[model samples]
Target: MYQVSNGIGFYVLATYFLAAIESKFLRAIPYEIELIPQEEYRSKFCYSVAECRASYPRAMDRGNDFFKYLLSRVVVSSVGGIPKYNVDEDTVIRYMWDVHQAAVDVGKSQLSDVSFYSSETERDFFMDFLLAVEFSVATLYRPYINSTAEFLVGFPHRPLTDQDRNVLASDVTVREKAFMSSVKFFSRTNEATGGLFLTVWKIAMTSEAGRAAGRFLIKRLLLIPSL
Candidate 1:
């Protein structure tokens, strides 16, 4: 298990951790957010639950990349004129505040005790969750989609196929195998902890292939989703 740090380790862990968080966030608040004043809706909208659900495997990838960009800049500070990477306790909380909770310095910081980057999208984020709740309740109790199977036919964009159904039917076994296969990349017991192993590993991560593989492995493995 690698750790997230103010170093290359951060990149190594970001893809996996962010994917997990994004998946859970959509699951927890699975509703399409609304936008008022058509103008605002057309611009500056971060992510829609429907879109993310439709593209579940690679969901929120663009946002996640931008999140990395914004976060990297935010965490950098000039230490005697040289910029250095840093992520204070408060900053960490703010990044994942909606996704999780921590022993935050309450009162001193606002927006769910994490400061929310000073109401920078964090406000809209909570609003999205609430809106999602209302939408879900309305759809269910009002018998909204009971009329058509189309509502349940698809999750976001992709229509369900027989293969997807089969996967769900044997979810436990399929997931177990998928998880084992994906993480096999990191299960090298023979490799030393230092020297060449560490060097090559870092080099690999510097390339797109290395990072992409990591992202895929984690989405399929640690998360243990049937699909």
Candidate 2:
């Protein structure tokens, strides 16, 4: 039963990923925004695209080098039987800001494209880019999330199945309480859905080329839950 249910659970997640949560957001970007000459936008922004890209290399680093490096040190320096340290929450938080900055830079570059859109297009594009950047950055934390989830898998408390309810019914701990809170949070339907929908609405209403880039991003993010 465990194996079968686990297999079904994995397929459920796979079905979500095939929805292309990230790719859709990338593709949603209107072509006019992409057509903007890199040189012209960079000149106006006073920096090159290379610099912009390099600024957030940590977020782009898929090998998890930074995370692994830190985790190794923590594991090696264990105190007593415990790992002795928690994952650095700062890394994820800082990366979020870095991703947002990248979005701002990309959105700003769109203004130089004179034929990009009608009068109101620019503002809309900026919002879309901002939200899109947010969505992209959010995906970057997937690793940390996976780590946290894995930690929960082998947790002392057993599954929430009815069979184990009696075992945990009379006992509670901070860890257990925290786990319950997290489960309750995720169990809520339409939480992410409504938020993404609002983001999509913002993008659709935008008129500028930059804003269109943003809209493209939001549209993509909105597909994540469906994935």
lDDT (C-alpha, whole model) for all candidates = 0.34, 0.37
Instruction: Report per-prediction Cα RMSD to one decimal.
Output: 20.8, 20.2
Candidate 1: segments with Cα more than 4 A from true spot: 1-172, 189-198, 207-210, 213-227
Q: Estimate each model's TM-score.
A: 0.21, 0.24
Query: How much does candidate 1 score in TM-score?
Result: 0.21
Candidate 2 per-residue C-alpha lDDT over 1-227 given as tens digits, one digit per residue, 9 for 90 to 100: 22322322332232222222222422464432211234533442223223323543332332133333344544445667655445555464444344434434434453434243332322333234334334433433233675436434422243234433334455555555444433323323224676765355445444445444643443333322221
Native-vs-model 1 lDDT? 0.34
* Residue range with the least summed lDDT across 10 consecutive positions in model 1: 1-10
Worst 10 residues of 2 by lDDT: 14-23
